[model samples]
Target: MNSRAPLNTAPPGMAEGLPVRFADVSWDSMRHDIEYVLVAPQRTRQPLLVFLHEGLGSVTMWKDFPYALCEAAGCRGLVLSRWGYGQSSPRPGHEKWPVDFMHRQARDFLPAFFEAIGHDTRADPPWLYGHSDGGSIALLHAAACPGRVGGLIVAAPHLFVEPVTLASIQQARDGYVTTDLRSKLARYHADPDSAFWGWNDVWLNPEFKHWNIQALLSAIRCPVLAVQGHDDEYGSMAQIDGIAQEVPQAELLKLDDCGHSPHRDQPARLIEASVAFMRRHRT
Candidate 1:
């Protein structure tokens, strides 16, 4: 059975208001504990905002951004480290992620995760705030379970694979081996190799090149705010543009002088835009 437990304590650099917690979630079709942090849980009735991290990100890697956004939006926030990220269980070395990993996350893991945490999405659908790979997962979830989602604020979400993205993933592979990337990632992930290779290997796999989700975008019925960096090295405007094309009601934001991660590169602007969007659609 799944259970909830208090984390030992906040990480050294975690913001004061956010309290970290752990939820034993049934993941990978197996029982696994996931690390998460709840911000402003006192605002229980407020619209919930769930933050989904980037591919290599975890609850700790998000730093204070979730807290900052939750405070600004006057909403409670749920920031979780996916199964193989952060303080959560490391991916088994013998296992390799399939190309449909993101699909499984949105279709399988997410619903179970909410149930494990006692969140009734049907009664009170939550707003999704996702970045990069997380953004794609949000899109897929919203599409798959439209009635259970309030809205979406996705940044740098890839609807289709791009040549530039593949190149950057290749570069990341090189950095992980030849540079200090592994050491840096080790600071956040329990097993750096687990986190790194789990994501890296799948993206670099030849078969994964055909992965795309544009067809599913039309299934999304909720309002969407798609954001992207003007200077993103991994993807071009086409990514967000494709989202707007499929999800016609979707609003788009292209930040100036920003790279891949708008939350880290331009937090204030992202917060302002996100807060405004939340207010507009607040239930």
Candidate 2:
């Protein structure tokens, strides 16, 4: 793993008045670091909101949503890319993502990341706002470290791999090799294969169908607001519904005529629901 590309080079921007800093958290399996941007709130010492990107997402992929949401809620935000995505360290070309990638992200990567950023997990628990795969990661993390997170807002998360998901991922595999997906992904990832196969190969594997964490939902003790769109192409409401059924204090928000990317498809509703959830879970 290369040690340099994933490291932060500068702040996000000055226009938002929220100070953004680049960060690097070391990992044992690889010598590289996972990179992230920290956005401090304008006037508060509230719990940090950690933004986790989608399967095909990166730090820049989240664009300005973190900043806007953080500003609206008057809280700091930390947006990070997993090892294979964004400006984070590139994985080896032959590296295969473990079936427990989401688990590793939640239990291992996030804790190291928060500590590296100088936030005390015991004193300043972060709120997780995860989308797609990131949402699964947030749920798994919150379940594993219930006391480390203040709240959760998950959008289009997956608890179990559905047949439809496998079929779609198989299609993506074909597209990555035979279509223009590679070139398109290159625009966001420094090494597109690292990002693509890291997510794709794992989801498409034959043995991954039973990789369900729905039972883990009950372990999440924090306030949770699970949101999903009526027309999400990647997942169904079963994702959030699973949370509501198991997590005693979970809230549900369903959006109409929306797609997988609610933050992009239904920005206003997403913001409103998210702001309300954050306020409701204020610690």
Candidate 3:
């Protein structure tokens, strides 16, 4: 375990007045350090809520949402920039991610990350809150290790690849080149190209079209709250609808006039719903 250090006291960010501590998690398979930060670390007795960012999202990209939600729910928060995103180690230039990248994250990286962070899921399983790609990851984790999850809250998660999602990713690729997407992403990621292309290329890969995790949803035994924007551009209602279908007890919330990101598009509503869900499922 790497020594914890106080993060720079930057105003109006995720940590804020809390003790924002960084951990260097050794990802044995990938041989890299995964950067993670804990909010309200002193409140260890409170339920743990792990926040997962989107494909283009990093610790910084999430801004104050994690902190806000954590406060409302009165829980500890764990926000981490996945490998190849944010200040964490970038993807190796020679390596290419497979279609099962999200699966790998859920089954492999998350467990290692939890161990490195000294979180014993078996003794105290944490609730998972994820957005977009992160949402999908949260579901995968819950499915794979239901015993280690207290509950699940996902926003705009993808259970399967959709034509609309492919189109949006393609548009993003064009925007990355034709517009200032790269520059904007640079504010959050150390190597924006690694983050961009790693996500973009895999989604656009023809073989990836068949990627799906619908079958795995049945394994998730914990309580679930799946939310999506009514106007989500990346995916259709079928995403959350599919969750409801598989996880029959899964709660669904469709926000009006919202987009792919419920945390950004309708945070207050999301937070309220999330707090209620966590409280209801609190063991």
Candidate 4:
């Protein structure tokens, strides 16, 4: 997070949180204890919104935004820390994520996480709100499990790799090495190394440069609103513009004077756009 970005304080009334377990999460057949939090669950009659965090983000990193969004949208929310993030199971020291890491997350881990939390996507699908890598994951999840996603609000999501993306990731790698980034990460992730290295290593890998999911977009059968900032350092407007190319039903939103994290940079505008979009497609 930029020093200028305001910090998010977790609000009151978090329900059914943490220490949820799921088995056989990967080829290694490792069991993982995924951490999660539910917000405003009392609104059972309303739609469910599931939040997926950024590459370096954890459950705690989301702070009160999930609650705030749910409140404004009159929806319930399920926020989770994916494996190797937040207070969930840390990545094995020697392990490296494959180029298909995001695919694995969307195809396998997400479904399992949903089940462990007792939210059956098929019986009652939920709207997905994601940022950065999380946004990509949400798209992949909706594509993979067609009818299971009610809708999506993906901010700064990457459908294809780009030189700018790699360059920014390299800058982050350098920051982690020469700055207090690791210490700052500790405030959110239990194992900052696991969180930082896991995302950094794979993204900087040569093979990952070719990673792309644009073809998967056509498979999505739900409404989608792709948001991006004109000043985003990690990617270009091509990210959201490319989304409109594939998923014709998807709407595009570009914010001015905002960076990568729109929810942090332009919360009011993002929230207003999201609430209206969610309602337009809400059942």
Candidate 5:
């Protein structure tokens, strides 16, 4: 991780804007136009922090949290919208994402995405900060890729499907159809159906009920910080506790009075812990 290439240096006076851009990448046997932005690229020598969004999230949905974290941690941040989210390419028709969709993104799509966007996975590995589904993807990436990424911090991640998660997702499915959820999602995704239905259909599928990664966590060889809110609707404390059991170097942060989104419900605390964690493993 010693190489300091200005692969994505921000344009002059563009730090405040965090403008969205696109990159054509070949991943999972297909070409995808990824939506992304670089935060504080002026700090070329600093470590790279990559933000992986949630199931229904996009680059815009992240708002200014990446900027705040990068500023506090003294690192550069790379935020991207995975295929089917934001202004990136939409999911093909109404097909559902495979049960191993996260696997594909972590083991295949992510590396290719980084390469297409000029982030050298070997020369300058990134520290992943993932939330919800993004968090699960982070765990899969860290486990499968081993040393490709520097380290990771996952918030409200699910290593397996839980009853509560499925119920909530079912509720979300109903909301998407009955309420204004689609209208709200339209603000962030180019095709809200691509993000919502793809994620929903897979999670609600019968085959996904037993999708578990507990066995793979041991393969992760990098520092890991697993954060979860006490009241997280998507998962219980067992998620992070399960991670700690497998990865000896893993640390856990359980926040009180918070929900599924720690960055939103507890930004100050999350940022402080994140800054400290990055500093401790700055090597």
Candidate 6:
């Protein structure tokens, strides 16, 4: 985050959350433990919003937006760091994320995390607000869980990896390996490589070029709002365009002068659009 950027509207809530361990899956002979932030609003059973962070993001990286958004929407929230992020355990240095990383995040890991957090997704699937890679995961999950999810808000999601994406990711890798990017990432993640390669290598690898989730978007049955900025460096309008095309009921919001992070770029507009979308989708 730039030092000159405006501070988050609300201060980050306390980060003293307890650790949650998920069973039924193993990574490196270890059952992963997830660190999460749960915020329940006053009185209503207002929808539960689960925030999925970016490829290199952790719970703390979200700053205060989750809290602010939850307050604005009068909803509860669950913000969790996937394994190998934030306070979660680190992935083995030699390991590489599979081509199915996003799918596992959506179909396998997410359900376990929510279950561990006491959220019975079978009864009430969450309203997912995902950024970047997280946005992609949200789309997959909503599609896989069709009738379960209340709604989905995907900010800068990718249905397919474009050349532009690989270029940007390659640049990021160079910055991390040769520049001070590691120190910078230290502010957000416990192990910067866990943050960096976990995203970079997979996105830039040759085999990942064929990775596409357009079919998953077509499977989504609930309301979905796909927002992106005109100036996003990682992807273009085609992302949201594909979503609208694949999911006929999907809504689109394109912003000017904004980049990859819509919530950070235009907080007020993001909030207004979100509130309206939620209301439109609520049962």
* Top-lDDT candidate index: 1
Answer with 3 or 6, whichever has the higher lDDT.
Answer: 3
Number of clashing pairs, model 4?
A: 0
lDDT of 6 by residue, 228-278 (tens): 999999999999999998999999999999999998898789988998999
Return the top candidate by TM-score. Answer: 1
User: Which residue pairs in candidate 1 collide?
Assistant: none
Model 5 residue runs over 4 Å out of place are 1-15
lDDT tens readout by residue for model 4, 1-283:
1112222434233322422222223323776777666677788888899899999998778766787888889998878778889877899989988899999998888887776556788889999998999999999999999999999999999999889989999999999999999999998888999999999999999999889999889888899999999999999999899899889899999999999999889999999999999889898
**Residue 191 lDDT, candidate 4, scale 0-100:** 95
Q: Candidate 5 vs candidate 6: which has greater lDDT?
A: 5
Model 2 lDDT tens row, 1-84: 223443334333323443334456776555456656667644456768989999989877777788788878888887877888
Model 1 whole-model lDDT (C-alpha atoms) = 0.90
lDDT agreement with native, every candidate: 0.90, 0.81, 0.88, 0.85, 0.88, 0.80
In model 6, the clashing pairs are none
Error of 3 at 75 (Å): 0.7
Runs of candidate 1 with Cα error greater than 4 angstroms are 1-4
Candidate 2, pairs of clashing residues: none
Comparing 1 with 4 on lDDT, the higher-scoring candidate is 1
Q: Report the C-alpha lDDT of model 1 over 61-178, residue by residue, as the tens digit.
A: 8888988998899999899999889988888998988999999999999998898889999999999999999999999999999899999999999888899999999999999999
Colliding residue pairs in candidate 3 = none
Deviating ranges (above 4 Å) for candidate 2: 1-22, 41-44
State residue 29's C-alpha deviation in candidate 3, in Å. 2.5
Worst 10 residues of 6 by lDDT: 1-10
Error of 4 at 68 (Å): 1.0
